[model samples]
Target: MQFENTLSFAKSLDLKDELSDYRSQFHFPKVNNKPVVYFTGNSLGLQPKRTKKFVDEIMADWGDLAVEGHFHASKPWWDYHERLAEPLSHIVGAKKEEVCVMNTLTVNLHLLMVSFYRPTSKRFKILCEEKAFPSDQYMLQSQVRHHGFEPSEALVEVAKRDGEHYWRTEDILAKIEEIGDKLALVLIGGVNYYNGQVFDMQTITRAGKAVGANVGWDLAHAAGNIELELHEWEVDFAAWCSYKYMNSGPGNASGIFVHERHLKNDKLQRFEGWWGTKKDTRFLMKPEFESTHTADSWQLSNPPVLSLAPYLASLEMFDEVGMEKLIKKQKLIVAYLEFVLREIDKETEGSFEIITPADRGCQLSVFLHGQGRKLFDYLMENGVITDWREPNVIRLAPAPFYCSFEDMYRFGQILKSGIER
Candidate 1:
């Protein structure tokens, strides 16, 4: 379909949209009197209107019954995170038992490393994409250092070909094969945070396994945003924060996946804790940690009920819409967004350059080559909520659940005005 940079065309697309009604479900910030055009769901999602009800229920339970809420509350705080496993598994494409909600993203990565990142005398190197999210870069560096190896010696970064913005799948696989026996683990951000490129997870996992290296992904921008088959991909483990496309609150709980093959394996070493023990035996205060024979084995502490409340609220919506429908809408909406950017780029004398590749999710990281910080400031003042990086790049992520065609159209107009004026 040829897109026209007109309100009528955008409205026509919106009228035919099945997911458009979801826009009303979230609470958006207002500028003047109108709701801001929110494209920063990649950073933090808008609050769901239903989120308050879920949180209030937990607050009420705590008020009515202090310690007893663990067993007596409507949802029961003790088993609260369990309810999320089934619903969240649908979002990330994992079996219910293979997925678990736990600590923050980097923390979970460190914990999962205990099991998957075991380095030996021969295989001590870890391979990751160049310029991974700083937290992940730091995590890998610290892990390798803890094992008594210099990061320069143990960390192998696959830099992109000289001028390319995205990492080529062949380059990554070739690097994996080249690393060979020295490679202990292959961990990368599934959807790159900087360029919005979706890595070929299945193929990469295969190559890593063929090389006898454990494979994992930091799905911070992948889960709930892309089509993931973690279990079928035979992924050793994966972890994702819930705030981005998942629409959970800021710094909320993180979801994790550990393949079923490892669930029953007791020989693997991991950081064990109280909540990770068998559910029946959990309250008994047993001295020895007994595996629940599930991903719960990686859990270190009790579920944070207050934080999990918002996450579970957001996940209830995911369960209702399902990732299948979400992805269906994402493909069309993201394409439309890309089309709008191209149309605007032509109108503005090619001031915009999209760095995000075709294999992106909801985000489009555009380099404003001919534009500058003033334009970014204008966008902020004009109620277009977007994420900005240094060197004049704006990461616009129109989450399918709330973002509409009209938002894209309006953004194009705002962008044109920002460029010309």
Candidate 2:
């Protein structure tokens, strides 16, 4: 397990990779007539080769049998959204009835908060990580304001220690105990988008439950990249976009999870639509809303077949290899990336620092001691696809699905040269 910088080390690791062949399954983008290294899957995944054909099938159905496509065509567009529940459930570690694929990530977050974030005089505060993704911050602020509570009074943001880059687990647990009485809900990201730190969902859920709080997760960065047992973890609800590690297309529909314990809980309220009504009598146009007895009761309208088709194709691929196998491979790749990053930092003598945690997921956020923007642009011009965060920090994600060990090594070589110049 010694860290080495030679190309031979990368080749040896690549040869031992079981999922190596899956790299060709994606349509990697090209630059100067060559495939880009594609370290940006943390933002948008590379498209699957089968994505076109998956959408084509639905397009053909719509073209050949316009109206019938809704009810009688192959896969039947009427119940198209239902077909994804099983695969989506498998990915998030939930029962089929407890999960539903619908809406975008932010939209689903808003909808889930509506049902899970009910506050009262005694318990009205929402606990979340400070510097959460902008959308999440906005969502939390608006939700608190909508409930007639001052955001400053109702939102408790957990921040990192003064000089530290990541929040400590002990501090978070202590905060839960300190304010458990006034807390109504805990809504935070499964993997921090900015720093790639993976939060302890199990401990967080346990802490929240002890304090009489409903808990939910925004899994935008964690769903496909890590192993999760949401059902066993007793998470009340969660939602995620599939475009990141899930390899679904950009702006793809997202998935949501609700614990089975809440399936019949009458206290839980939702913004209902006709699509969420009992399917057996949905076409009857009943005036009263009779929600389906599962997570599908949150659906607001019929799914877009084209969007869902690509997700179905991607989820099938996820089901084939399985999450455990994917995560095992990911740990190896990211560990290698971290090792190489450290080597570069040592070579530079404190010119840059890795802000992301060592035990983080695939991403590594590099903070340059000086100007990071120029270094990021230099790397991009040299054909490295790493992203630059504001002020400092270049985020590099050597994704498991398509990235090779050589990609990591090559990135290190280029990064060293970039910073030195």
Candidate 2: regions farther than 4 A off: none
Clashing pairs in model 1?
A: none
Q: How do all models score by TM-score?
A: 0.99, 0.98
Runs in model 1 deviating more than 4 A are none
- Top candidate by TM-score: 1
lDDT of each: 0.92, 0.88
Best by lDDT: 1
Clashing pairs in 2: none
RMSD of 1: 0.8
